[model samples]
Target: MDFIDEHLNHIKDKGLYRDFKFFTSSQSKYTSIDNRRVLLMASNNYLDLCADDRLKEAAEKAIYTYGVGSGGSRLITGSCKLHDQLEKKIADFKGAEAAIIFNTGYMANIGTITAISDQEWIIFSDELNHASIIDGCRLSGAKVVIYKHCNLDHLQEKIKIHQGKKRLIVTDGVFSMDGDIAPLDKIVELAKENKILTMVDDAHGTGVLGDNGAGSVEHFNLKGDIDIQVGTFSKALASEGGFVVGSKSLIEYLRHKARSFIYSTALSPVTIAVSLRSLDIVKNEREPRVKLLENSKWFQAKLRKLGFNVLESKTAIIALIIGNAAKARKLSEKLFEEGIFITAIRPPTVPDNTSRLRITLMSTHNRKDLKFALERLKKAGMELDVI
Candidate 1:
C-alpha cells in the first residue's frame, strides 16, 4: 500500500483520527476554544493548582537562575542540586526512604518495569491497567498475567499460577476510566503472604486522597509495606514530570539502571521548583483539598439524585457511563454546545461497549458551577438517552 493511502485507509477503517483544541486561558472552570468560553470538565488538574500564581512565580525564579531546559541527559549534565532536593522532598512527602524523578509518567513506569524485572520475575497486572504499565510489562520480558479488575480472588488465582517465579504485582491506584480505587490493602496482604514485590501508579490518587494527600499508601495506612509509589507532577502538582519513590537502595538502582532516567533529560529546573512549591501548598493550605473532596461528594450526590449513573469514587474522577462510542461522543459534543465541556472516552481507551464521559472535578469549581454542570449533563443525558 502507498504511504498516504495506507494511513488514510487506516483512519477511515478504524475511525481513530482525532483533533485537539488549544486553550488560551488557565485550566480552570472556564477554558477558551474556538473563541468561545466554556466550562471545562476534562482536565486532570484535580487540585486546580496548575496555574497558581505562587507556583508560577517560583518557576519564573528558577528560569532566571538555571535558564531554560536541561542541556543534556541527567547522567551526563542535567543532574542539578534542585533535582536532588526535589527527590528528597518527594521521598519525605510520600514517607519513602528515597525518590527519583523521571521526565514523564510513561517513562517512569516503562523504565522501572524494564530495569528491575527479569525472566525469573512474573509481572501480575490488573486487566484494566494503564497502557504505560502494559508497555512496561512488555518491555520487562517478565511473564505477564492479567487479573480481573479489582478482583482479589482472581488476582490470587493468577499468583497461584505464577507462584514459582518472583512476583511483581502492579496496579493503578485509581482506575482512570472506571473511576474506582484498587483493593490496595487486600493486594498488599496477598503480595506479602506470597513474598511478592508491589508497585502502584498513583497518578490520580496523589494530592486527592488521604489526610495530607499522601495517596493510597497512606489512605490504607500501609506504610513501608508497599514497595513503590509512582506519581506524576502533571496532575495535582500542576507541573510536568513524574517520579518513583522507594527504599534508598532501590532508588539508587533506578538512578544507575533505569535507562529512561539515565538517558533522558531530567525534568527542567522550573518544573522541579514549581512541584516543590505545590507540595508545600498541599501540605499547608489544607482548605483547597478539603473543598475538592466536598465538591466531589456533592457532585456525586447530585448526579444520583438527578438519576444519572455516576460511577463511585473517593477521588475527583467521575465517570458517567454512556456505553456507546457514537452516543458518548454525541453527548460530549452536546455538553460542549451547552457550555459544559466534558471529554467523551470511547473504545480502545476503554473496552468496546463501556464508553463514558470522564468528568473531573477541581477545588475551584463552586456550587454554582456544579449546579450548572449537573443541569447541562442532565440535558445531555436526556438527549443521548443515557439516563
Candidate 2:
C-alpha cells in the first residue's frame, strides 16, 4: 500500500496520472461532460456513427430477438446467428477466406500473436505498434525485433539479421498516436522476398481509409497479401469487439489455440448486430469518410500555420507535439476551459519528452465546428505558449 502511494505520487508529479471524464451524453463531435457541452476532439469515432439511428435500431431488434448477454464463449452456446453473420461479412469486406471475432481489439491482437508464434518464431514489429500488439508479442515468447517506426530499410536489415524458418512481420496499418500510415505495400514486398508471414492491425484504418474504406490494406491495394489481418469495430465502425481475418486454416487454428478467445465470453448479440449494421453503412457511405480525411488534412494544415507542431498524417488522428508533460497537461486544461476537449498524451503512450495533444476528428465535425476549435486552440496555445 505504501509502494502504491509512492508510485501514484511519482506519476502525479510527472503529470502522467490519468483520470476519466464522465460523459453524460452519447459520443459525437459534442458531448456533455459535467453537464457542460464540450467540443470533443479526442474521440476515435471517425465515422461519427456511435449514436446513429440505424445502429440503435439494429441493437434494439437484436435485443428483442436474442436477449442481452452472450451466455458463454464462442465455441459454446454463445455463438449465435448474428455472430456468424458478422464474421462472414467481415471476411468478405476484408477479402479474406474466413474471420473470427473477439471481445475486443486487445483480445484479438493478444490472442492472434500468441497463438501463431513461439520461441522458434521471430516477429519483426514496428516500434510504434499499439500496446495490445506489444503485449501480444511479449506473451507469445517470440523473438520480437522492433524496427524503426515504418522504416522499411531497418525492418529489412532486422529481417536479414534474424533469419528464421517461421517469421512474421506485424504492424499497425495507421498508427493511432502519430496518425502516420504504414508502408504495407513495401512491407508485403519485403515479406514475400524474405518468405515471412505478414499481419496488419488496421484498427484505426478500417472504415476510414482506402477507395472503399476497407482500410490501409485497401489503401495499398494489397488485399489477400497479408496472412493475418486484425481489426476492431470500436473505433471508426462505431461498435464493439475485434476480429482477425485470414485463411480458413488460420481461423480454425485460432479457435483451437487462442486462449483469449477460447476463455472470454462472446460479445453481446446487440453489439454484434450494431457492428453488422455499421459495416453495411460504412461500406456504402463513402462521403463521410472522404469528408473526414479532407477535414483532417485541412485542420492539420491550419494547426501548423498557427505555429503548432502538428505531425503529418493521412488519417483522422493528429498529433500536436508539446514536448513537456506538464506543459502538455496545462495546454489540455486551457483548451478544456475554452470548451474544447483534447487529451494530452504523455509517456508510455508516447516516448518521454514527446508529450502531445492527440486530436481526433469525427465525420460530423463541419467547417464551423473546426473553426471554433481552431479559435479556441489558438487562444489556449497563446495562453500556454504551446504555439
Candidate 3:
C-alpha cells in the first residue's frame, strides 16, 4: 500500500486528488451534501427524470413483478421478456435495426469495441475520447492512431497513412469534459470514402440531442451512415444501463462474442423498467429537451458575457476551463461555499493546465436556480481573477 499512498500524495500535491462527495437526497434542484442543501449543477440528469414520481412508481411495480435482481448473465438465466422489450424499444428509438443492453456505458464500449476488432485492425480514435473508449481500444489488441480532437484534417491525414481491412474510427458524439459535439457528418463522409467503420459513444448526447432526443447521430442526420451507436441510460435517460445500436447481424454477433455481455450479470428488472419509461419520456416529450437546450444556451451565454470561457457547446453539458488545477479546485470550493454544487475536473480526467468545471444543466432548473448558480460563479471568477 506504499505505492497507493505515494500516488495519492503525488495527486494531492498537484491539486488533482479526487474525493467523493455524497448526496443524501435524490438528483434534483437541491441535494444535501455535507448536511447542506446545495443547488445541484454537477449531475448528468439532463432531463430531470431521475426523481420523477412516475419512475418511482414504475420501480415499485417492477420490483414487485420481477423481483430484485437478475439471477445471472443473460446467456445463463437472466434473459427476460422485459429485457427483450427494452432492447426493441431502444432500437426503435435510435432508428437502428437492433440494439443490445449491457450493465453500464463503460462495459458497452469495452465489449463492443473489443468484439468488433482485433490485433489485425487499425483504430483511428479522437484524442479526447472518453476513458472507456480508450480502454476498449487498448484491450482490442488493435493498432491505435489518435488524431487531434475534432480535427478532421488530422483525422484524414492519419487515415491516409494507415491501410487495413478493418479500419475503425471512434469518437464521442458529445465530449464529456469539453461539452462539444463531434463532426459526425464529416466523419461519416470520410469513413464512406475510405470504406472504414465508424463508432460513436453518445452517452452525453442521448436524450438531449436531435429531434425527440434520438441523439447526436440524428442531430447530424447520419443515422444509417454511422456503423455503431453506443449510449447510456444513466445520464439524461435517468436509469442505469447502457446499450449499443447497430444492424441485426451486428447485434447478434455481439450477443455471442462480447465478453462483457456474456459474462456480466444482466441489468436489474427495476432498472430496465425505469429505462423503458425514461426512453418513452425522452421520445414523447418535447418540452424537456427544448427547455434543457434553452437553459444551456442561456447559461453559457451568461458565462461568456461574464468573461468566463464557455467552450463551444451546443448541448446541455458545459465546461468552464480554468488553466491551473489549484485554481479550478479553489473555484469549485468557492462555489460550494456559496451553496452551489459543482465539481472541479482535473488530470488525469483532463489534461494538465486545463482543469475545468464540468457543469451540466437540466430542464428542471428554473431561472431562479440558474441565477443563484450564476451569481455564485461570478463571485468565484471575480475573486479568483479568472474572469
**Which candidate comes out best when scored by TM-score?**
2
CA RMSD for every model? 1.6, 0.7, 0.9
lDDT of 3 at 199: 98
Taking all chains together, each candidate's TM-score versus the true structure is: 0.96, 0.99, 0.99
Better of 1 and 3 by TM-score: 3
User: Candidate 1: how many backbone clashes?
Assistant: 0
Which pairs of residues clash in candidate 3, taking residues 3 or more apart in a chain or in different chains? none
lDDT of 1 by residue, 129-202 (tens): 98989999998888899999999999988888777746799999988887788999999999989999999999
lDDT for 156 in candidate 3 is 94
In model 1, the clashing pairs are none
Q: lDDT tens digits, residues 1-387, model 2?
A: 799999999999999999998898998888888888999999999988998999999999999999999999999988999999999999999999999999999999999999999999999999999999999999999999999999998998998899879999999999999999999999999999989999999999999998888999999999989999999999999998999999999999999999999998999999999999999999999999999999999999999999999999999999999999999999998888889899999999999999999999988999999999999999999988787
Q: Between candidates 2 and 3, which one is better according to TM-score?
A: 2
Residue ranges of candidate 2 with Cα displaced over 4 Å: none
Where does candidate 1 have its weakest 10-residue lDDT segment? 10-19
